[model samples]
Structure formats: C-alpha cells, structure tokens
Target: METKRFYQQRLDEWVEESRKQAYKGRVAEYIPGLAAAPQHALGIALWGTDGQFFQSGDTDLHFTMQSISKVFSLLLALMDSGEKSVFQKVGMEPTGDDFNSILKLELVDPGKPFNPFINAGAIVIASLIQGDGPDEKSERLLQFIRHLAHDNRLDYNEAVYESERETAHRNRSIAYYLKDNGVLEDDVEETLEVYFRQCSIVVNCKQLAHMALVLASDGVDPVTKQQVIPRRYVQIAKSFMVTCGMYNASGEFAIEVGLPAKSGVSGGILSVVPGKWGIGIIGPALNSKGNSVAGVQLLRHLSQDWDWSIF
Candidate 1:
C-alpha cells in the first residue's frame, strides 16, 4: 500500500512536469479534426501486471488512435492471413524516413512495404483483414480493439474519420501506388476506408492502458486471463514497436526510454514494460518525428526513475 501510494504521488508529479513540455511540439494539422485539439493537453494511465492502476492529468480526454492503430491492425492481419500471406505483402525492416514515405516502395524491388507499421504497409495489412466489405472489416477490427480494452461500448469518432477521409490525399496516393504495384488485394478505396476508420477509433488513456495491458501480458487478457492474440503474434508486434513504432525517432526512443511503444499522431502512446506493466499516454503536441513530445518525455522520466528499460 505504501509503495503504491508513493508511486502514485511521484506519477502525479511527473505528469505535471511533463505537461509543460507540450509547448515544444505541435498538434497534427493535416487532419482538420486533429488540428482542433488542445495543443497543451497531456494525460497518462498505467496498468500493472498485477492489476494496479494509476492515472493522472487529462485521463478523460478522448482522441483517435492515428498510427497507433497500425499495431493492432498488423496483429489482426497476421491472424487473418497467417504469417506467410501477410509477409508476402510487407517486409520486416524499418524505413528511417517519415511514416508516410513512398520513396522506398519505388526504390525497393517488388514494391513490398518495408514494415507494417508505416502507412503503406498498414494499407496492405488493411486489405489482408478478412471481411465481406470495408464496413465489416472495420467492425471486426474495432471489435478486436474493444475486446483488448475490455470496453464493449468503444466506437469511432466520426468527425475525425470524415476529416481524415476528406484530407488524406497523401494516404490516397500511397494506397493508389500500392494498388498499381499489385500489393493491395482489396479495392483501394475500400481498403483506405477501413484504414482511416481504424485510425479514427476514439480512446481515452484508461482504455488504451487496458488494451496495452493485454499486449504487455503477451496477448493474454489481464482481467479474464484469456488469450486474445497468439503469443507469436504478440512477440512480432512488440518487436516492431521497439524497432519502428516511433517513426524516425524510434532509435532515439529505444536508447532513452528503452521500452516497446507505439505513438500516434493524436498524441497517444501505447507502451509495454514486458511482463510488468502497460502504459498509455496522450499529449497532442508532436515533435519533429510525429511522436507526442511531452508523452515521450514522461515515459523517459518514468522509465529512468523506475528502471523500466527492457534493454
């Protein structure tokens, strides 16, 4: 009890300190909905392997998953199409460029995406998800996410979804390129609809932490103690999160925070402390590499203070 209390006290302090760092970054403006978010808002939620929970700051603030949805979509695609089929569409290496870069696709022969975490790879993964149509595919993925978070009522933020749909010209270009390369199996528009909807799934810090707990436990639902994702898929997902989840800053994040984590343009981060803890954070201000600036700083603080580094 004393230890929990002390940890909580320090966690609160860390959030306040980290909130000030939000000014150093900017909210994503390409998506009109995201641009309207509070530039300085910050929040965090942590769920321990043993069920302890700690949250502070803007815990109730809701935001889209953005790129963080790639993690779960990759897992779902792997489950739907199996390893061989999924790998045929995307490679396992990280591209050090921006997450939306298409230069590598043209540079690399056969045109497979370097990894599923990037925009191009995620579009392919979206097609790989088994469903009758875009709506079904999106619903199936959404159900999977809700199951992970143990929240049955979770749904999309339609405004953000529509905003992304209307303004995602670059994403459309990437999808069309994949279609031209024969890398995408589904209709380009259908696949992108599913992709955009998945990215717009709204979540708060507590729900994200709960979902991360399942991943932290290696695909086991922490509350029910049931296997939601196979252990092998979880291992693959974590590997990607560590190596490429933070876009171009992944290397620096590994050295500093030393945890497997995925960050979204909505200023959300879902992180794992191996078998010990699951963490979720949101700070709309993004650094140059498109990660939540204050959220990264907060993770660095907690990881250093508690020696949470896996490496």
Candidate 2:
C-alpha cells in the first residue's frame, strides 16, 4: 500500500513536469491530416497489474495507433504463420533509416525488410495474415485489439484513414515494388488497404496502456485474469519492441528507457514492462524522429528513476 501511494505521488509530479514541456516539441505537420492537432495536447496513463488505472492530462483524445499498432499486427502474423515463415518474409533486425523508407529495401537487394517495425516490413507482414479479405482481416484484428484493451468502443479513426490514404502515395509505391519482387503476398492494393486501416485505428492513452499491460504480462490481461494473447507471440513482440520499435532512434531509446516501446507520428507511445507494467503516453508535439516529445522525456525520466528497461 505504501508503494502504491508513492507511485501515485510520482505520477502526479510527473504530470506536472510534463505540462511545462508542452511547447518543447512540434506537432507533426508533414501529413496535412495530423498537422492541425492542438499543439499542446498531452496525456499520461498507466494500468497496474491490480486492475487500477492512473491517468492524467488530455486522456480522452482519440489518436491513431500509428506505429504502435505494428507490435500487435506483428504478433498476429507470428501467431498465424509461426516464426520461420513470417521472419522469412520480413527480417528481425533494425534498419537505421526512417520507418517508411524505400531506400533501404532496395539496398537490401529485394530481401525482406530489416524488421517488422518499419512500414515496408509491416506492410509485408500485413499481407501475410491469413485473412479471407482485407476488411474481414481488419475486422478480426480490430476485434482482437478491442478485447485486449477491454474497450469495445475503440474504433477506426476514419478521418485519419482518409488522410493517410490520400497521402499514402509512397506506401503504394513500396507495396507495388515489393509485389513485383515477390516479397508481398495477396494483392498489393488489398494489403495496403489493410495496412492503412490498421494504422488509422485510434485509442486513448488508457486503452493502449491496458494493451501494453497485457504484453508486459506476457500475453495475459492482468486486469481480467485471462490469457489474452499467446505467450510466444508476446515474446516476439517484445523482442522487436526493444530492437526496432523506436524507428532509427531505437538503440538509443533502448539504452535510455530500457523498455520495449513503439512510437508514432500521432504522438502516442506504448511500452511493455515485460512482466511488470504497461505504460501509455500521448503528446501531439513530436520530436524530429516522430516521437512524442514530452512523452519520450517522461518515459526516460520514469525508466531511469525506476530502472524499468528490459536490458
């Protein structure tokens, strides 16, 4: 009880510290759809293993899962196809480029993407899910996410999807190239539709915190006392989260925060505590690498103070 009370104190202090950082990061503007986000938007939330929730700031804003969804989709693919089959399509190593780069894919000589976190790799992995159709597969995937977070109301961010789709000319090019080279299965357009839709699914910090909580608990929903995802799948997901979840800054983040984290342009960060906790953060302001500016700072502070890194 003392420890729980102490954590609550720290959470309040941390939330206070974060509001001061509101203007330190710029809101993502490259995509016209996300450019207009309220610059100071911020939120922090944590779900303990005991079914207690700790949340603060703008906790209700619906933001897309963005890159964070890569972890779940990758887990689903691994569960469906097993390790060897999925890894053969995409690698398990990190690429030191931007997440959506076509440059490294070409340099790798038509080989699979460096890891499942990058857009090229995620798109390929999305193609490999054993789905009857893109929509059906997406529906199933959303249902899975809803169950994990225990939030049935979490739904697609249609405006973000349309915005991403309209601006996804680069993703289309990558998908077509992979199709021509035989890296992607199913139809290129179909795969991209699924990929974009997955990216567009939106949730608040508390929901994602619960999702991360399950992963941290090794695929069991700590609050519900149910096996939500396979342990094997969680292992694979956590491994990638440490190595490739942070885009190019992953190595540094892994060293600093020491947790498996996934960041997105939407300024949402989802992290696994690997048998401990699941932390979710959101701040619309982004650093140059497309991470939540204040969120990253907050995690780094907490990880260092609490020694939460998996390494």
How does each model score on TM-score?
0.99, 0.96
Leading candidate by TM-score: 1
lDDT, candidates in the order shown: 0.94, 0.85
Candidate 2 has its poorest 10 consecutive residues by lDDT at 104-113
Residue 33, candidate 1: C-alpha displacement in angstroms: 0.7
lDDT of 1 by residue, 171-262 (tens): 99999888888998679999999999999999999999998999999999988888889999999999999999999999999999999999
Per residue, candidate 2 scores C-alpha lDDT tens digits across 208-293 of 99899998888887766787778888888888888888888989898888889999998999987777678888898887777887
Best by lDDT, which number? 1
TM value for model 1: 0.99
Model 1 lDDT-worst window of ten: 103-112
